[model samples]
Target: MPGSLSAYLSQVEEDGADYVVIDTPPHAGGTIDAAIRAADLVVIPIRPGPFDINAAAGTVGIMKQTGRPGIFVLSQVAAVGPEGDDTAAVLQELYPDVPVAKARLGQRKAFMQALISGQAITEFDRPSSKAVGEIKALFREVRSRL
Candidate 1:
């Protein structure tokens, strides 16, 4: 289980998987480090706040050191406010080269409800809802870039 990230990635490649999404913890750890180093492109999901932004800076540094491209995805952002824009501005100023995702996943009850139901947002009721649309758009962006 430990130290098998590379092996798992190899297996995915060998199996011809279309996409490999590895979710890493916010803090730096061995597994996250290994995943960032091995990732073709790293997606760092950050909340709209100073602390989260700062934390992501450290991770971005590691991605840069590994010579891997990394993008920022603003998660659980409030829809009706300038806070998300401000946060995106801060990230853009900090990492001018890194692309800040245009698609922001707004904080909604649907996501939590889906989690409680042990299903993905798409699998939840009202698959054509706005919540599902945002996720689908985000996925398409990530997929196209990859």
Candidate 2:
């Protein structure tokens, strides 16, 4: 039962959301199988590290099995120094089918600040320029997917 799986696809259809951002557990469990089965497009978040890139091999294959288009988002990118570029370069070679060409969501303290205050980044700090820019660009990018 490698690719055979069960998910809330029927409920998702009924939920009527314009998009779904599924956060799967970090393993090939029933949950991941379910999400893959339900997803129309899989966006794999990659951290710049050896193990992280290796993990993506399984991720790419799993997403492909669902017959869905996929993309990779480089997350936790401190800076594109040797380590970051090296990781990205290797990932490109590994999962050529998945687009690893999106803007990196920089690791920002604002995210933690907003989370601690129990607010979305948009509402967390109206005057914080960083939060405003990140939220705006994030929405714009997501909207482009449609």
Top candidate on lDDT is 1
Model 1: lDDT of residue 91: 95
Candidate 2 residue-wise lDDT at 83: 63
Q: Candidate 1: give the clashing pairs.
A: none
Candidate 2 residue 39 Cα shift, in angstroms, is 0.9
Q: After superposition, how far is residue 103 of candidate 2 from its true place, in Å?
A: 1.2
Number of clashes found in candidate 1: 0
Off by over 4 Å in 1: none
- Our model 2 lands, by Cα RMSD against the true structure, at 3.6
TM-score of each: 0.93, 0.77
